[model samples]
Target: MPKLITGGVAVVLCAVIVVHLGLGAAGVGVLDVLSFVAGNGDENTRNVLWGSRIPRTLAGLVVGIALGVSGALIQGATRNPLAAPDTLGVNAGAYFAVAALAFAGVNAGVFGNGGVAFLGGLAAVALVYLLTVGGVLTPGRVLLAGATVSLIGMAGAEFLQILDEHQTRGLFFWGNGSLMQTGLDRPLVVGAVVLAGAALAPLLARSLDLLSLGDETAQAMGVQVNRVRPMALSLAVVLAAAAVTVAGPIGFVGLIAPVAVRLLGIHGHSLLIPLAGLTAATLVLAADAAAQVALPPSAGYGELPVGIVTALIGGPIFIVLARRVITGDADRGAAVVVAQARKSRFVTALVIGCGLLAVAAVVGLRVGDMDISWSDLASVVTGSGQEMANAVVSFRLPRILVAAGAGACLAIAGVAVQSVVRNPLAEPGLMGITGGASAAAMLVILVIPSAPVAVLPVAATAGGVLAMVIIVLIARQLDPTRVVLIGLGMAATTMALVNVMVVGAQMNITAALTWLAGSTYARDLSTLGWLLLPAVVAVMLIVGGRAVNMLALGDDLPRSLGLALGRTRMLVLCGGALLAAGTAAAVGTVGFVGLVAPHLARRIVGTATHRLMPMAAVLGAVLVVVADTVGRSVLAPTEIPVGIVTALLGTPYLVWLLRAK
Candidate 1:
């Protein structure tokens, strides 16, 4: 009964906000809109009502309800409150599909674009699901897989945007999330799709309730877990795709709406589902109103993308919720502790792994643009070849060192973050440290182009630290997984910020492309020196204490061990910030070295203690240097960014890991 009342209030609020907002060139009041609607008003007012305000309102309504319900379904299915259209790559898929079509000169009107977006969204969801395929769907695996796909999709989108300026403008505006009308057909189609999805959603409510009890329990209850899971997912994808097609991928509404409903203590889907829809409606209406009024007029005449505005508000709220989860205030069952047991066989193999890294370093110098034989390498090292000595010393040697150092530093940061957070997936890149650093560095370059090159590292470090601090503070009260969710949120914000910057800069596209792709061997000696200093400092910090061990036991265990949890967390975070920032500042944002290295290390040396820290660091260096070498040699004159290469390699490995475990 209370749920119904709350929903009623939400609906009223949504209606008020929607009706009060003026539309188009001649703004009309609520009474004027109503008078025009009732067939008792001026032709201009009637045209304005039918042509602009009504379509805009309907778009908001349909899109809001779609995102809200879709969010709830995704969150329930994945058992992750952070799961939503944006987080799961549904919006990305839709946006990219439309953008591609636009660039291809496919004048797919709104309805045609909707169809394309729907297919694309379905494909993306299917890919994410397949990547994390296992006996049971785990939240962690789903999130990781979704994240990987989102990154790949976003990268593709950015690349396409660079290739076509007109499409880029269209996507940029669309990506911001708007309720502006292209035509009335869009709202009608979206409305029909949303209604169909809503009807199907209730049918899954029982299964969702059972599923929330987990796969084992649901199976025991004869829930046909497999079939039910896919059905729910299909419904969610349809809703999300429809929403994106109409409103251009508004973010966080779905994530925030269901969470809001859940927090309101409406657990039963019969009640929570409708209320969540209402909450979503209210949120979008409110956000749209704000976007119309609050932003500077010179920014954009139409409206700030409602999606970006939602992110600005919803990101912080999500972070707060995540912190609550991390602190064990929300869900105690979510906290995880890594066991402290070592295996001799794994340790032995890890030593062998280090030897392989040494070989990789040697090979890295020999496989670049100018391939030098081992004899040439030896001659150069021994100062025997005075002829090619300068070439070897100035170019090949520095490149090798850059690759090795960056790989090692990133790997160590990944391992340290995982240890500190007690989550195997807690890498710097995954957690937005690299993205933050990259964004900050880009800002520094844009605003103060004449600043010393050395300042890039400093700016990156500050950005990394700032990002880490935001995540930590927000997740301080949540569980490790929740902290990971907050990191994902930060990653989204950072990526969006980067996109905006790249679009607005009008800089050389090649430079932007190189940076986004994660090049590592572009720096001279001064940058190299800056990178090396931080790499050394990070290594020292990682090797310094038993804090790593205590941290793996989760927050409580560390406190019980008489460790100063706050100080230790700060120290580890600082080390990681320095490492990621310096590396990002030196090279571009290298991909999955940080993520893949620690997992690879754990597989070889076992997760016991920080005993494997050094091994992981060395292995990370090998992975990166080898990837860099492959990136350089594979295309000859045209070098692929090492980051892109790593993604290609690491994404598969991650999927394999998910399936194996």
Candidate 2:
């Protein structure tokens, strides 16, 4: 059965590749490609097949195998099925290295860039591993550390991109996970890495099998757990680096391939590892093929990057899998209950202090562009300052409202997701919800420029919901922490898609830049109306619900309390989806607010309870407003988007929270 499944997959993959080779922006067919390969074809067919198709196919195959093997190695070493190359910060490191090189006007040869990328990948893995290491390596700690590194790396990359537009344009296509073959060296380098990984991997298979039995058991079984682990991780890093060198961090194949193999009942190290490699190769090839043929002819003026296609497909699959894991079929008793603990007096004071900070945020808003005083503010609100009223009502008021609403919604969504997924780091931004929304919005805008403004929000909402559904389903077979890891995979894929769109379509990249930085104030009455209704509905549904309260206890106890697990879970997910999508549609993918607000709320309330949902919402709104206000005023007449400010502020707080815990 397993052989049949693998064989079937192989056949499909081959057919897909053939189709890809035959089809292009210029029309061709299988017969033409075959004739070209045999050197008996027309000039046009020969040029198309040999120059474009063959190289692209080879690049995809090589990169795919590299990523697949890397993912398998990481999962094996960590004993976490969700582990992948990106989990160790390899992608971020490679991206940053390339960005730096490009910014410096250093046009390295393909091999030279590959070498640098490999070194960067290795360095990132080493740093993350060193930071998280104790006597034993914990997958959870590694994931958190990697996330921190990725954030820092991304911020640096963005700064560089802003500083140099020429470099930005050059790196953009590569960043989107392009499989456009530069030369034969790409495949040769990737192939060498895969071969190396294959040779070294079997040496650790016995150790890996023991490691999967848990650290204590592995040690008891005479495995040198620590010694073997570093070696395994090193191998994974090398493989991932090689892949990134060629394909620029095409994500999720590493994640999807091994898991797919496991699902096919190929769990043994010997069988599963090879199967994962093949599956990964096939997936990338198929995606590349689809990018060539499936897209509209007009869409691919230049070659469409394969990464985007994979991300669009992979993100939904990951989300469904996540949801399934969280809502287990067998009721494991009532969701594990968090005690309804009240805040102490000191904590209460802190809450009041934060509230005061929020008031100051309102004042901060008036300090930008044409400054307005408290007197002017009062007059505008009371309709005394007619001229100021024009500015305040039309400009400042809408900006503030959008910022506040978006922040609150995102924060609440983050908190709900983190609680359900049982991970401190889980947020819509981190989990691919933002990416999914962004991609859908980009696609809508690109394909239908004349579409109504309302269509963008609708598209974003649909994409977010689709992603959520896939994640929820995938989570069924794994622990909540694993769900977060899978979500990261999805997030990377979605980001790749966005990059592809930005590069491939050559759209107004300034718009993408603005949205990515999390600017507020795009909201008009129309946007407000669309967002407000959903936000209100979500708040109403979750605010006083017993089921939501029980959910904080964890999944096991809710069932014991007579809550229908599936139904309750679905409701909560739907509510979260609405909250995230509405906020993204309104404010263009704000960051850090969702992550920061709930953590602060939990600090104030001293527990996670659905009753505190209102408080969290309010706090989220306040935090976002303050961040946006700061963003506007920090540079006076010029404005940095609210998203940048929140990320800068929120990331430190997240680190502190994690460290404290």
Candidate 3:
């Protein structure tokens, strides 16, 4: 069965390669290529074949093989079918390394870039290992850690791109995982390395087979468990990094390829590695072919990244895997609850938070390209001021208001979501609302450039709510962990869709990225109006404190207490989704506000829904105001997006959250 499957995959891969080679802007056709092979070809056809088609086809094949083999190795070592370089942050790490390399103006050749990618991938996997080491390495926990690490790596790459836009011109699409190659030199070099790594991989086949039995069993059987695991994982990282170096981190190929092969009931490490590679090569080529078909090169939509296509397909597959393998219970997760604070202490924290937010707003008004002093500020308020200073404050004032309102909405959304997810670490972004909003907004922007500004926020809000609804319906129950996993998958799918539109439309990239990064740039009172509904929802949510608190209780307790658990969960979740999506519509999806602020409030005032709600709002407001201030002030003209700033703050907090007992 395994042999038939492997051979079938090889044959399919050949067909995909042929189709991929034939579909291009050069008007090359499969029949033309076949006739050329039969010795009836022109120079132009031969030039297209040798110059563009062959190199691209070879690059995809090499990358697929590398990712597939790496997936097999990691899954075998970890004994988790969901394990893959993409899930473990290796791909993100390698991608960031290459972006950094470009930013630094380094002209490292093929071999050197591969080495750098290997280091990045190795480091990322090692961090993931360290984070999950204290636990049993369950699929859910490891996957969460990997997702967190990926967020950090992506944030870093975004920061670099913002700082040096010139250096990262084509980096955005490449970062999304394109297979367009300029030449064969890089692919051939990386291919040789992949061949060497694949050969060394089988040397650990015996140890891996035993290790699959369990560490103690493997040790008892005289298979050095410690040494073998590291060797296999390191080899996996090398393979994954090589693929990134060559093809810009095409995701899910490694994951889909190995998982697909494993379903054939083949378990041998030697056979799994090579067979998975063939399957992966086929998946990559096939996805590329599908991309070409969806948006023909001759149609002028530009080449869609093969990675985007794979991500779109892989997301549902991941959701399926999570549903089957993940128990979706919080039995093993650390407590997210906190004891209530003293009334006086809670009051003090709120006061301090308010003060901080005010100070941040003031600083934002005062410290842009020029400073507006107190006198200038007062004069502006009194309708008499320095012309330039008045203009700066006038421009900054509405944005600051929008930032504060959005922040409060996000924080309350976080509080409402955490109440249900029962994990203080949970954020609205994980609910798929933000991603859905961003995706919808991008689609509108690309599909209808003449869309009214008001239409964007409305479309974004509706999209976000719709996304959350899908996640809720798919889970069919309020399983928090499962919901989170499904949300992640949904978010990936939405992001892939957004990338597709971006690649095809070739929109104004800076504006799109800033919005996607959750910027408050150019936002005014009209945008501020978008927050009114969320603010009202926030007030109502806080007022319904008892129900929100009841949600934090376990299922049986909530039911016994006569709380309509299902209805209440839906109510609070929908409200949270509204606040998050509405805020996203207004500010373009500022992240970590919903997370960091609420979590900090919990630490200060505990998890009492009423107290937590207000405290979280204050803190969240302070966070975004400060973020906006810093974004505008830091590089002066070259502003960092508030989302990136908040990510820098929130990533460390997430890492800490994962390590919590």
Q: List TM-scores for all candidates, in order.
A: 0.76, 0.77, 0.96
- Tens digit of lDDT per residue, candidate 2, span 314-347? 6656555444333221233212122334575544
What lDDT does each candidate get? 0.74, 0.70, 0.84
Point out where model 3 deviates above 4 Å. 331-344, 447-452
- Write model 1 residue lDDT over 470-553, tens digit each, in one string: 888776553556667789778767866765566456555456766766886565555568687667866686566477667656
* Pairs with steric clashes in candidate 3: none
Candidate that would win on lDDT:
3
> In order, how many clashes per candidate?
11, 35, 0
For model 3 the local lDDT of residue 464 reads: 85
Residue 3, candidate 3: C-alpha displacement in angstroms: 2.2
Which candidate, 2 or 3, has the higher lDDT?
Answer: 3
- Candidate 1's C-alpha lDDT? 0.74
For residue 577, model 2's alpha carbon misses the true position, in angstroms, by 3.3
